[model samples]
Target chain A: MPIGIVSEPGREANEFKFITPDDEKLKTGEFVYYNVSLETEDEDSDLFSKTHKIFARVINRDECRGYPDSFLADPEVNPKHVAKKLGVISEDMELYRMTAKIIGYYDTRLNDFTNPRIVPKSGTKVELAPDDDLEKFLTNIEDVAEAFIGDLLHRNAGAVDIKLPVDNFTSTHLSILASTGSGKSYTCSVIAEELMKPDSRAAMLILDPHAEYHTLKEIEKMEEFKGNDGYKPKVSIWGPEDIRIRFAELSFREIISSLHNPSDAQEQRLREAWNRIQSSDDYGQYYSVNDLISECIPEDGSDAISDALTWRLRNAFDRELFDHSRNLSISELLEPGRVSILQLDTISAIDQQLIVNILFRKIYRERINCERNRDTQLDFPVFAILEEGHRFAPANGESRSLPILRTILSEGRKFGFGIGVISQRPSKIDDDILSQCKTQIIMQIQNPNDQDAIRRAVESVGEDLLSELPGLTPGQSVVAGDSVNTPFLCKIRERHTTHGAESLKTSKRWRESWTKNAQVPDKVVDADQDKGAEDREELL
Target chain B: MVSKKIGKVIGSNSHIDYTCEIYRKRDKDNPPTPADHSFGQFVYIEKEIDGKNIHLIGVIYDSQILDPDQGRTGPKLAEPHEQELFHPSYIEEKMTLAGIALLGYCEVDDDEFCSNEHCVPPWTIEIDDIVRTLSDKDFLKFHEVDGEINLGYYQNLMELAGPFGTDLLSKIIDQLKDMKPDEEKTLEVIQKNIEFSKRIKGV
Candidate 1:
């Protein structure tokens, strides 16, 4: 039979079998089967004829082909009686065409075919080819969003080694820039999740200025599949320990300097007093700055040391001295074997900056000490993820913590500690810190300042890639750094939980409020009558 | 009998003692006399009993000064004072006569017997000195003739002769004389003799 020709009305055309047939004359790679199907005219018609438009090659003419019985038993014609009537004979009656090219054959098995193109009698054709457009193939934004979140639970083992291909984020610094509602929270969460993986060996400490990351608690409890089991992600939260300065554990100098003084002379006196106290054996043992000041300043004459000491003692003893107790200290939060989050929800931006600086300094000091004391060459490495980093490490040298944080950005790598900064205003973050980041997982960032900042930070990022950044769909990020083979946009694997980034649904809320309060005059009168009748019934 | 032979080989009659004095002027104008001297110097002399030319020097301080007239020839006139007054000069002269006397008995020429210069005793010897000279090999041969010598005894005596002694050469000759011509034994003896000689010469 000629290939691609439909069968005539009453001709005995060739029967195509996927396996060995009654006619042993068919050769390998030769067209053997005539594609035919039954067409129904009206709602009920028993008379059916074969309509052929496709052909199959004799890929395996030596073996019997087994066809699924359901395919042979037409469901529409005889749904209830089909299975009983068809039985094993269904395999011989059904027809199949060779839909692929037979490349080679194996003696033990059958020949292998590739690029299968299935042309059903009336349905859409299905094409099977090697994946050439991997990016496009996986480019479905919704699917990628789901995978980006879903993969957080069913973590592929290969995912742990997939670092964002950048260098020196911790040592150099970085920023996350996007519009307020443009999945900045979700992108930060994804970065946090990637860093928190066991192999990443990173510690995520979110400053959480707006308390937005409190949702992470719920996300961490989302279902994660392991083999056949499920688990909840684990993270630890830390806040200020107590109201006292001793409990807060500020270094003596930090406490003295943070105090407010009336004049330059008072400040100088306070400095000398602080120096004396620090040089003394009993420094930093006091319960509050007031106690420390009271002990340092003596009741005396108008010498600069005596006058300054008295003023400092009086001023620092006030309630304002304990103002720092509201913010948390990093030393209290840094416990080994746990991912610590220092939520700075209660503090202002300036105070948060101070707290983050203290935390970074403490962590850097501890890591350096640990490395120095290690007996062997290999030591455990730690990563510190700084969320909302712009407040602490700001552009234009405004942030009080910038200098120290810049030091960390420039030197943290050699100490085996890394830093990750997440911000929505990349332009506002320190350039020194941002430029040091070797890996960048850029999400949708539309702001020109943020784009320019990112462009300046990553010198190697091309203009083409930079232009593509603002248009990136939710959950899709462009990963570029030493970790990635190339700068390619990746569909972030889905998170395991449904707790996506919470966004303000303004229109829906407004419409729901309007509908809730909408009423007519007649409805109000009926409602008043119903209430009166109910009251009368209750009296009876 | 070996003792007598050894005594003759060592030249018992040719034994001599020579003494020399070194003087220091305490003060140039009024030098202290020997009687008033607080310190004195002497040599503890050793003579090689065998023909080996070994000499040892030892310095002595505060040694007793014996009567110089007892050993000197033309200086003993009368009293002990007279002898004491010229004792330093007298001892110097006696030391020179002793050197002459020893030179006359041996083949060592006068030029080789100076006190101030380093010299070696002559290898060639007069008949009188030959009778007196007991070479270590001759001493070992005397022991062998008296039937007192065993392989171990001869080995010990040869060891004392060290590598510079003629005993090693004599042992090589004796090894070559065995009628059975034990080439292996002869070579072993020669090698051991060479090793001994090298050790003594420190080469």
Candidate 2:
């Protein structure tokens, strides 16, 4: 057979080629269909369902002889059977081929058979379809394993990588800011949990004014899961009786203020008597610092400590040398192996400030001294987290402990002393101390003043990022600063232990009480009250 | 670096060299006379420079000035001029000789006070003032030839010139042409020579 090529529809064929015996069986000028099956990865095979179609064409057997082997292989047949087999031919797949000259392609919603459509070859190098199936398959399986381990690990581990920030916090100060319900507390809990890990030798002391951290005791009760080597969180309570001090520690003014009333000359005599008593060997046995004050001093206008000293003097004059007072010294409070929580719940806000200031000053000074004494010069780092910091670290005036705190911020890195001042009202905290923090975890903050305070404190934060603060949902926070390599907007993991802290639900309580009394009739309550009234009248 | 002692009064050339092993103390106490007080209270002087009218303060103890071969020190005075000197700004107390050459002076009366409450006496010369005094040709020459007119250079030149003639400005231009700009080395020198004032100067 000979196949010829024609330039025009009615032009005579000039170029011709001989067809082999295999091609002779095909009818000349007949319409035939060519079918191609596209193969892909098994997982992605479903993507080709809509695109599988056979192309039909009329073959000029004499002219096809001049054609290539690929052209001769296709049958010169009508697409009549191809339509029935492919199921997409009657649905304008043929019309698409005639107009666009495309063979096989995946159909899209936007494709219109009435107009010429652009289609891709089944096995073409260029792919029009999205290639997400392979990536999706891999992600789906990996997500399952991630979820499984997620449950096994504590919530702190699943939260943002806090270790990097914690390590940075050792050298730099950090701040955590967030809005209400933005998991600020949970983030704090996570930090506390991480710090308490056995391998972490760092000591942490948190002043939880709202009693939100009571749930930590519950988290500690969980059985050690895999990878967690029997680490437990311990909490100790400290009262006023833990501190120890001597009369010499008192200032001259404090000693004078502790004396009882008499003439000016008598007051001098009282001071002399107090000095003589202090110098005796049995001073500790005959009188604690408090005993000397009560015997000699009048209780007119005196400081709280002076008043306490006077009261102690009048009460126990014969106490033994080993006698322990109710109030403990600073050393007792910071003793190792004890996570001391000085519960100020029963104390007044003013007293809490005074007490916290005393403790902070003592702790910072001790840590500095300890660092200097070490031969190898290793510091026992302690983190002091103060909740509701605005009350103690107020902005209006310098705190009594401000000097010690400033020293810690400026020089505590080498001494291993870290301080975390937590406050909802950032505007009320001292600006100097707030600016020193190198790490900050910010939650949703709706108050403009607080936001402005935070903005001023963290000079590097942009206004656009601060604008997003108020809308942040619960359990979410923006963690930024030297602690994190890059600022991250992260959803804080839920605390493993349920928080005892919660807003009061007034409506729910009312509804539950109403339901409980629904069984009793209103008339029954009226009759009982009337009966009780009658009985009382008769008795009277 | 030999510290060029400064005087409390303008046009006075008595310098207390800080680099000297022992501090020189005058046995006779000559308290400052009311006449000795001038609007430009602080003046710069070389270590050995002496004057009858000026009261001595301290010297410019800049390390860069000691090593003249390194070129960190600015242009030296072709000839030392005996005249009153004043710092442009109260913020700076000391500067290198090269630094002093770039900034020009603004003349003020001996009793004239500075408008700024914080600045020491002898009000600073503003860019506008400099432009007003120098001719277009001289101004163009300064702009093209003088070292970068940064805060340090301006303050240093003003201090060296004090209230004297405009010779320091020309010297700065010659120095800029003589040396090539080495940004890294220049910055290092500037960092090493920074000094703080002992007391707040009158404005």
Candidate 3:
């Protein structure tokens, strides 16, 4: 059915305003269509004798009441009474106008999309597009199940499944942007579930700040249906206790960048100590921070800064965190459809950089080697899902992971490598690297600066869509870039496994405790006494 | 095709494009105003020009109504002056008129009628043409083969059944539940919708 009549005409930077009667179905973000002609646009166009239907996304909605200004301008009548009258008068007083941007044309020939040029004349029809129509247009009517993430939420009215083309998206990298509690973890787990599908042939490595993705090993309860219903996931969990980076692998640049801040003399001593330790090669296999500090010597052989170096090294990190153990090979870390989650839940902020740096360097080397037929495990693509990216790849200060991460961003796609950087703070993340991620899955971001960062970084999604970021309810997101046929707003389907990282309901817990404690058993008590009786009680 | 009585064409203008005003007044005895004036409903006025059967399709997009001049007839309208209240004063009956914008004739330039196509006719609509909303048969016929508009906000607007809507998609699914194969995506959506509805009810 026609929802509105096209008020605007022609398709130069195409935009149109249509009066959508007082229908609530005609809303922003909905799709509408009108019949246009391809014949007029091209003289050689064949006489298909069909409607060259132009498709557009509703970006804005305006409401106009037919009431004259006299009602508002009148001071004699009570304003409250006037409002009541208007409410009782009728719905006819209100008019709804929908503004839509022409995204593209649904090309029936190629069965996908052709560059939209033809424009509908004034008074063309516009209506809500059905779910099946969307499915046909978006997927080109093919299953093409690459990495099925979620369903499209049609305003609490309808739902349809949607999938992403993973290989095409990985080259540009992806960012899952959301507010702290806006189903970010749930969405991430959905991606993990999709990747771990048997035919996906992709490996995922999650750097979990809260050890959330570690719950991928858990199977969903069968009583209620879920994604990970009956099968055991090929997932491994590695926490701080099971994690250690070999100190011998560290170069001078890596060591310097990893350290918090060292004075000129301290840096010299540290560098000299590392050089001496390398020369000896007899400090067993594993060398601690204490060992490196002990072997240090200034050029003048002074002990003035020895205590400072020792104290700084001891206080900066858990001295026992680093040890000279051979890092796990890529084969042990990654496998087809298997996920390795490094749980960094209990560690300090600085350690996140060190761990990511060490792991990233090893994966980079193995993948590069595999490319050259140099006997390595990473023959297939590896997707590293990095959480708290702003911490490791901060816009400001230096960090151990920054340089290695830069390399991965610049050339990882060429070598079957991609990274999914999950960050709540896009503004804090390095501008260069943040912009490099072409495919961005943005959720409910409320901060202005973060929204601005997204606007600057994302080129495909229009400002009209970006303006909607803050208003998006949880589980709703705008998927932009080449990952989708067109940049669309969709609701992610529910994950088969539990989103273990969900926030605790603190108020509910408090209320439940009160209810439970209300039934406290009566305790042994002394007989009640008056104020004066307490004085006589001692005598009694 | 017989259409549920929607409204009657009371006014029209062909100066810019074929536009008409539908007097959507309710008849207490036989009320048919509700379905007639909706913005997106496909409506048309039939015209026979030189033995050519023409169907000028249109959509009702706007509505307007002048406030009744109650000052001359009621207390509120007479607030400005005392003399107007006592005398026999009457205001014209206030009514709403839905504005209809013409899409085009149904294959006027072409020989064969394309049920799905929108065409621009060489002629405009006449003042005497009666405007009527599309029936379910015409609606189904045109929508099935004509155009399926796919939108970005598709997911947001779609609601699962038990609470039937203008689309009545849930009822359609319920009627076809046993007949639909399990392998189809349609079946999956229906099952999910049922589960979602059950969960919401339980909550």
Candidate 4:
């Protein structure tokens, strides 16, 4: 069914204006197309039909004709009635002029659109593109590796399932950018569930800063993820106390950053002791922070520098994380069909950065060794998602993890290592790190700086879609970049596992507490009040 | 039903408004009175265009009573009854003139009047064209175009009816509402708008 006719050329070359009486369906972001007859080059060069469908998106609409202003003067009289009295039909009263931007013709060979660099001529009939065609051409991905994340936004529910390729996003890196409480963690859980499906039994790691991903353990119990070949997925959770890093693995900078400001002489002495201990026979295999401290000798027969270094080292390395010869092995952290979550809710910000730095470095080197056919503990690929990515690779401040994360993001594709950075503040994340993730799932962001940062970094999302970000409700997102054929709005699917990061019910909890307090016996309350009065008198 | 002849076209002061002289009696009905040619009454003059019968529809907007013997100081020639016996054609000069504003036209077919009404007429009426009072049925049918109540000649009527065009249209719309009960609400809206415009424009 044809919806409208091309009225004239638009303000831009790739845009055209069409007149339509359909005020309901032909809204902004609607997909419509017109047929164009291609000029054949030769008589025998014919593999397809000459008539091709040129798709376009409706970008703007304006009313070109309506009832006169005077007809609407009387409040009680409807404008339609006035027009009817004047011998005009009700439907003919309003005429809308829709402006559409051409999205080019779909090419089967390329599985994408091929821009013809030409717009339809005037008087061409433009029809609404059917849902079947949109489902076929809008995305190009294999069905086997499809991660059924959500459906297309603005379309009817379940009209088009937006299935992204797990292979593309995992290999090239991915980012989930949204404001707080915008379902960032919920979308991540959905992806995790997809990865743990029977067809994909992917090895994954999540650096959960707030203990929000522990609910992923439910995947092991779900029947959907169990394979027919008796294969069941596994989830491993490591709390803050169990997350350890050997003291010897820290670099000179990492060690110095952990301490308060140290004098130049103390730093020099520490460096000397560090190098000496590193060259010793038992440095990496079996060593402790006590050894490093004991090795720091007095300079010029004075014990001032060594004594000060001793106190700082004891204070920084006394935590359970920096242990001696006790750290998680690479083989234990990553395995096929297993998800490992390292909960860092109890750790401080600086220690969290150092932990991420060490883990990423070890993972990168181990993957490289495995790819090169050398001795390695782990041989399979693994993808790690870092929650609150801005704390790891902040733009305004330095972090111990930023360099290694950047290195892994840039070169990890060949080595079968990938990173997913999830952050609420895109502007605070390093520009290079944010751009390296080729796949972006952007939700509602109210901050102008974050929106501008996305505009500058993400080239795939157009201005029209960017403007929709501020108005998007929770669970709606704009998926763009390599994983999708074109940028589009998506309504994220529900998570198979229960979400763990819901906001606390403050009002309900307060009411419950107040009710419980009111149920206390009157005699007990009087006794407590008498004791409180006696205690006040004693204090006075 | 046959249309009752009320008068004949006498003269015209303008192209759209024509003067018609009303008669005191007609053959098929009782003696015609002033009410037959009253203001806002539907009337038409039959004419032939290109060998086809057409009726030029109009409405009586104004009326005049001519007494040519007013203010005559001459001696009394005879009594009123004796004058009628002596000079039988003397009373003919005392006539009633009606000002008819042409609204539109309708085509006549077979025995039916106003088979299809048009808002614009291609021809004008002659001096002696017989003006007849349109029946209530034909009057309603003339306003019905394409099965809806269409006052397409609303602008023309407003322009040609002189100072009292708004009042005349209000009266016609009221009659139409009573005849067309289905379109009563919509016609009421139009009537309210006309009343509002009359008050604002002070016409």
Candidate 5:
């Protein structure tokens, strides 16, 4: 149904003004269209005529006509009721002048909008674009492997289902940027569920610092993720106690950075010891920390540097994470149809960084080897999600994992390795790494610094969408970049698995505590009261 | 029903305000009296446009008594009662003039008086057009259209009535309230507004 008529051209050529009596439906970001007939010429000068529905989005609204202010002067009286009493018909009382930006017509062959470079004349009827048409025009998800993320936000609930391209986002990196409690982790879980579905069985890993992703174990019980051809996705959660790292896997710099305030001479001595160990004829790719410590003794009898290096090495490597023979195996952590969640809640910040550093470096090299047809434990492509990404790759501070993360982001696509950097503080994340992620799912972020960081990092989200970041409620997101045809707001779908990251209900807990205290009995009888009395009498 | 023939149009100050001369006769029974053509009276003038009869609805706003002998110090040749017998033309010269502000018009078809009312009348009042008082039924019918009390020409009445606009409109609303009780709620709002406007103007 036609809702408005074009009034005139706007300040920009791609924009035009329209008049609508409806005050509610034509809100900002609403899609509308007007039909236009055009003639095209072929190579032989033969003409073909066709009609196209030119689409536009409502950007702004101003009240052009309404009930007089005096009618609303009395606080006790309703303006509409007053207008009705005054014989001023309600239908003609309110009018709005809306400014809409042209999105052009959808070209099916190109799978994108084509600018017609034409504005509708005054008095052209502009109708609301139906949800079915928008569903077809928004994304190319018909026969391709897709992840059902959510629905289009501005439309009615369940009107338009938003399914993102699985292969596009999985190959290219993805980023989930949101403030605290904005359902960023929940959205990640939804994506993980989609990846584990029967249609697309992907090998994915989640570096969960808060242990929130363990709920994804529910996928093993869900039939939706099970394939009819005897395929079932696996969920493996490795807690802090179960994770192990080898001292030989850490680079020289990584080992130095993991120590607490290592002196310059001690670092130099450690590097010399590392070089000596690597150059020895008896050395192997799998050497223990004891071998490096043995090589660190000085030949000149300088005991200070060597003793200090031993103390720091023993202090850093003497943990459950570093083992001589046992470590997280690549073949077990990454399978063709399994989701491995490495929980790091019990580990400290430095240990967390070291773990991510060692794990990502191993997986990245294995992916490269697999792509080259070399013998590798991880022969399939893998996507990894790093929670609290800023901790591993700080912007102002240094981390052992920043360089490896940057390498994986820039060169991982070619090697079938993708990384999703999920961070609440985008400003603290490394700019290079944040920009390298080709697709971004941004929820509400109120901090100006984080919003500015997103603006600098993500290029696909326009200023109009960025302005709406502060007002978006939880579970609402603005998805942009290569996974979608255009940047648009999305109402995230409910997760298949139970969400584990909900906030603590402080008020309900306080109320229950008061009730429990009030209900406690002040006086109580013991089972051996008479026996206790008799024993007291005997003692007296 | 045309209750009484009150006056005839003598002249017009504007397209909306007309002046009429009242017909007063002491010998005739139930003749047009001063009360019949007094202020705030709803009246209409009959006119034919394109062979269709219509009533130009208006209200008496002001009046003037024209006495030809007011300033004369010299005595007449006959007494006041004898002057009508000796000089009947002289007695007929003295008249009562009523100022009528046109509100709107209502179409008339045969005995069915008010078929429809329109705020914009295509024709103006002509000189010597007979003015008659509207029956109570016709007066109530004139203010109602589409099953509601419509005063679409309330602004015209206010503009043409000059200083007594609010008072005249309030009187019409008060009279219609009693005639149409079902629409009293809506009419009271208009009445209160006019009363407030009068106080605001310090009238």
Candidate 6:
């Protein structure tokens, strides 16, 4: 029962010096508890005294090991197994003391945990929190509208799988940052999966550039998590073929802004051409890019300006960037609690920007309308998620979508317009937007500049966590913000849906192909490929 | 035949108090492992004060073994081999010691024999007093005789209040299934303990 003894009285009432038995697991960040009766003065009282135990978090550990690592490394030195029988310099016969900060104590009278009012006397025996106590602390829910992200990890131990209130987490805006292979997208996928739960009614719109999340439509079918039967995420995938936006719906300034850095004079001339087409009876109603170009070609606003406008318009026309029907509405796609992924991979960069610009603008406007008027059809808040956010909200270069995104990040939450910016390079994300994101889901980031950027942006993340960021395993993240009771080091929970953004194992694929080709006849491989092509066609 | 004296009460603190510490030395002959002063093992601090042989009874609720020189003191630990040359090996070798936490004592009649009634002892022990094992044989000595007892004895031992009390209750429960003292005597002892707590609670 006496696992350890309080060695030092901490500067605070709750902090204590705990001398622990030298188990390899006895290290910093371990949780330990010391028994302390609330009424210390009632020494003679028996059953009436309210005895409570205070829980403390070990911040640092110090040990006097039996032998040097060098001595242990030396092959010539026989391990002192005899020491165990003698109870001398054995491996387990070492002393370790941990500096633990008292977290809080359970109030038996109030039936809830409260901050420590009295410190346990020095030499207090410390023990591991019983399973029940640990479970109660970790599983206590702060709010009902919580977003289930992952299991909270306590010093390599799983405390509990708890939820983070999305109302606090998302409405304040959030950023998921990590290196390319550090499970950044997987973390986002977990969030997406949670959002798309059948019972959830929060809308999430993912601006996916590589069509990474389109497979979410069949994610529940993934063999690993097929047990999650009730988890059906209402996913709507929008690709260029499935979506159409009228060119006439875009303003003259929006049209000119999509050009490759059009000069001020060129912008002015294009604006005049667009004005002339709208003013005329034949094309005044709703003009397409072709009509705008034809009007520009006959304009008297200089031939050079008309030629530039025509070339830009012709390029957009060739790409089939627009349709007469304005059918893609964020209100329709990002319905409450539904997950919609726009596969912008098929669209050109210029057209991608124009489309993202329009989508974000519409979402922002809808949220504003919803906030102002309760009668708005889509009354719920929506989180606009941008994958590879660096492309859209780059710190260095300006993009057509940046202005509206900046506006959303700054004031969107006020109107139930939340933003989730997923980025690998936190340093490359616009500081204004990054700073506005109150909750930061930081995964393993090895870059010092990115770490520095995160440090400057997130005041809640301490030096200890910042130091630990680079060493975190994939799918492990530190959640720091007002959303959680405290900053949590957590292992992301298994996604109910298949992780659609996982990188292909190039080596494994190559090995399978080469080995199969060598073993099988060319005719057989050809037939297999033909069949695979047919299967793929059917899947499409 | 005198049994081996495993430890002695440290005179600096009051042995009469419900809780006390016993220090034991391990030499060449006694290479005492943690097993020597295991938890839940009951013992007695025996002394001849004014030729009145006394026994201060308690249970070993906890034990701490230390070779201070080898065991780091401060929260600051040095590098893996930090104290290799700085600390004297002689200190570690000679200072190997154990301290057992003893809480709960019982009352004995004038004839130096325990009775059905137990109480917190009034006498303390000197450093010279010997700490000897209080085995099941010693527990059986408190057979049928009645004596003045502490009113809170039931709360201290039967209700399972302190470390020793809980351990004693557990020990009794373990023995109960095997009918160590038979059902009648066990029932009588339990009834007496509850009656004592009820009387104290009424007061």
If scored against the real structure, what TM-score would every candidate get?
0.43, 0.41, 0.60, 0.78, 0.82, 0.59
Ranking by TM-score: 5, 4, 3, 6, 1, 2
lDDT minimum window of 10 residues, candidate 2 chain B: B124-133
Candidate 3 residues A214-234, lDDT tens each? 667863223222334443347
How does chain A of candidate 3 score by TM-score against the true chain A? 0.79
lDDT of 6 by residue, A325-386 (tens): 55565557877647788888877776676777776776677678788884564678888788
Better of 5 and 6 by DockQ: 5
* Candidate closer to the true structure by lDDT (higher is better), 2 or 3: 3
Runs with alpha carbons beyond 4 Å of true place in candidate 1: A1-174, A218-233, A238-248, A252-272, A275-284, A292-332, A374-381, A498-500, A507-540, B1-203
Q: Which of the CAPRI classes, incorrect, acceptable, medium or high, describes model 3? A: incorrect
Model 5 agreement with the true structure over B113-193: per-residue lDDT tens digits:
656554657788888898999888888888777666667677778887878888888888888878889766656666776
User: For model 4, what is the error of residue B76's alpha carbon versus the real structure, in angstroms, after optimal superposition?
Assistant: 18
Off by over 4 Å in 4: A39-49, A67-82, A249-271, A281-286, A293-320, A324-330, A522-540, B1-203
lDDT of 1 by residue, A196-315 (tens): 433343444665666565555544544331112233345676543331233235554444434443466555565666567666776444445554555456666356555566565454
Q: Which is better, 4 or 5, measured by DockQ?
A: 4
Off by over 4 Å in 2: A1-163, A224-231, A237-282, A285-324, A328-338, A374-379, A398-404, A510-540, B1-203
How well does candidate 1 score on lDDT at residue B136? 35
* Backbone clashes counted, model 3: 23
Q: What is the interface RMSD of each candidate, in Å?
A: 57.3, 40.2, 20.9, 2.7, 3.8, 23.9
Which regions of candidate 3 are displaced past 4 Å? A9-12, A39-51, A64-94, A106-112, A139-145, A155-159, A220-232, A249-253, A260-318, A326-330, A508-540, B1-203
**Model 1 docking grade:** incorrect
Worst 10 residues of 3 chain A by lDDT: A79-88
Q: How far does residue B151 in candidate 6 sit from its true spot (Å)?
A: 52
Ranking by lDDT: 5, 4, 3, 6, 1, 2
Worst 10 residues of 4 chain B by lDDT: B24-33
